[model samples]
Target chain A: MFRTISNPWISLASRLILAAVFIYASIDKIAHPDLFAEVVHNYRILPIATENLFAMALPWIELGTGVLLLLGLLTRSAALLSAFMLIVFIAAIGAGLWRGIDITCGCFTVSSEGRQLGWLTLLEDVALLLPSFQLLLTAHPGISLDRRYLPASPLSAEPR
Target chain B: MKDWVAAHRGKATIAGAVLIVCVFGSIGLLRNAVAEHPLAWVAKPPVLVKYDRAVRPSPDALQTVTLEDAAGMAFDAGALFVDARTAEEYAAGHIQGAVNLPTNHYDDELPAVAARLEGMTLIVYCDGGACEASLQVARRLLKSGYAPVVVFTGGWPEWQGAGYPTEAGGTPSP
Candidate 1:
């Protein structure tokens, strides 16, 4: 069971899935930074001073992570970041729910009236964390740029 | 020594993630700086309120209202709520006591409703967040001789989200 769970194919699949999710999530946000800023503010989690900075930077980070995972370059690193982001998302959604903040999830869409922030949104983030953890744990760069470019890297050095 | 490797097993990966964040974050900031309209460093609430000077007959003639002010005025007998959303939306829900005055139907409805609006403060609103129907209606009201017209920029979403007074599926309460 452990070997199957840690299989190279499984790791590759996880990386690709997370990559698509991140890339799709980043597009609207990058195009509409001002609206995205408003969405981030609606969460009311971050300090007001930091909201715009966070809104501007986060989508790009997701885009970068997505591209890296898509290419399977720095697979472990991208996976780690993906997991970290999911944790933050889960927490933010949880906080929003706790405070009864009736807001759109601002997950895939930064639109004002998109998906409402709720337990289902929290669950979706939590489920994405599974694939992120799989990629992080497996670190199996199957047919990947990481395998070709970082041959001597510690993660790639493990016996197949 | 072996324990240290275990402790810092993914240190390089962590560093790589940090580097990716810094690199991409810098790119985002740079792109934002050079963009035509740079995003504000501090995000304000999603209220894009601009009281058009050209449309205003007088400086104090047109005004904007926050949710708190609108809420306070809701109870005032002299203040009347006018919802500028479509009639269907108005039927779905609206601020309690607000009259349905759909922007599209303004010409047909205004003549009938204008006389009833005399000697009262008009608090106009729509669906909010970039929906300018309220502004359009408010401007028309100003032209029609309604004084002290206040546009609730936050509008219905903000009011509904805040759990303020609202009603549905009826002609607006008197």
Candidate 2:
């Protein structure tokens, strides 16, 4: 049921979109680390100590994964990681809505976006999930280094 | 083991090992770096239970003032009027000489406010009628040691109805 994008142009487009999302997200968080930390705390998910650590590490993870994905380096690993992080975000947004907590999502906006714990945020995350899933499915597609660096044929059969 | 090592000797294995090391090491180092910066979007400093409880302003601390009371005062030269509404709401219209200090996230912004209005009689208000932002802000200010914080319960709407001096798109007149 999934559309496969084996074409080089399609693959490039997908990679670019994913990379742009990550890069933009990372820069925004990097600018206002403390506010992002508060957003994490508002989720009421992690312990206070770990919240800061996660906040710090997550954006850099995004940045690293984005760069790696853009370069088609370890495409599968990067896509999988991005997908997993998106899932966690969806869950957090869902829980926040269910609990009726009016909190500003530090997702995109630098300042408070007025605590819209609604379906919109959840839907936006789901939309992001689609591209990630696409990348994951076509993890080692022809255009990637996975296909270039690692030969398609078995290495063991090659004569020394 | 010797045969396996000899057969597997290639650039592929080295590249794979290097990639793994780099990814894992980068993750560790990134975690350490983030722990130091503590970005607000990702995580926030813990809200101490004691401080949270202590900081919550008492309801009675806010003194609700009537329009007449506000009008009667001979504009105490040192009195500072604060509009505890959103900037948009304040911009649409507000009591003349009132500064905007929206109540949402007041805890984060109050310290800066306290610094500015030190030793000034602060009058806080929101929209007329049942608006609580003014009272909430007034209580918070009182908690922060702002003396004589008066809440104009009859807010901007009332001030406008009384034909009081009003301004738009600029700082209010004293």
Candidate 3:
């Protein structure tokens, strides 16, 4: 079970999938901080003062995490952060659903006309958690920048 | 714990990711600083309530009123309080005498209430703290030719908290 789970191919697939998700999610948000800030405000979870700062900072975090994951540098930590972010997203969406507040998800796009917050969004976040956990648990350094920097070990000594 | 950390190469990996995050975060902040309109760090609800008995704000401008303004408007003869909350929320509890014109259903609902809104000042509000429905509805009202539309930023929660008049159970028919 451990060998199958730790397969280099599985690690690579998980890393690539998460990288695409995060990068695609970050673009529009990075372009329009104002719209993103409004979306963040609608959540009503964070304090008013922190909303703008959070809006400004979050997309960059996503972009950086995505780029790092794509390169497979700091793969385990990037996956760890991805897992953390997914949990936060699930919690925020859960809170919004509980409040029955009519709001856009602001997951992919910050536009007012974007996807409405719903149970499906909660499911999507939970689904993304699978790959994040996979990478976190077994990040293979082979075929990644980590191959050179990370100390060679059983994870890196792939039988090619 | 130490072995677990070693197996995952946690120390260096965590450090690298943190460094990347910090660098990118600083870049984002700097970019926002130089942008055309930097977002407000702290939200301060407008003090339109203070305008009452003082100089009325320009008719053309969208005014954000405080709870006091909404309460005062509740009794004012020409002023009409409009609730932008959902019908369910409106039915649950709302400011006394406020008409429901929920922002979500603005298009479908506006026509039903248009005749009643003619020649009246509209004071719009929602659930309060961080709720945007009031502002949205107020904008729609202004566009629909309702002049002197004021947003009660401190909305139902503030009004109810202040021991102001309230109504519940059944939303009045349009």
Best by DockQ: 1
Error of 1 at B42 (Å): 3.3
Give the TM-score of each candidate. Answer: 0.68, 0.57, 0.66
Please tell me how candidate 1 rates in CAPRI terms. Answer: medium
TM-score of chain B of each: 0.65, 0.60, 0.65
Candidate 1 Cα lDDT to native: 0.80
- Candidate 3: CAPRI quality band: acceptable
Candidate 3 per-residue lDDT over residues A89-156, each given as its tens digit:
99999999999987989898875547889999999999999988877666364477777665443222
Candidate 1, B60: how far from true, in Å? 16
The DockQ assigned to candidate 3 is: 0.31
Model 3 steric clash pairs? none
Q: Model 1: runs farther than 4 Å from truth?
A: A155-160, B1-8, B44-91, B95-174
Docking class of 2: incorrect
The superposed Cα distance between candidate 2 and the true structure at residue B23, in angstroms, equals 4.9
- Candidate 3, overall lDDT? 0.78
Model 2: DockQ vs. true structure: 0.16
Lowest lDDT 10-mer window, candidate 1 chain A? Answer: A151-160
For each candidate in the order shown, give its overall lDDT on alpha carbons: 0.80, 0.64, 0.78
In candidate 1 the C-alpha lDDT for residue B107 amounts to: 68
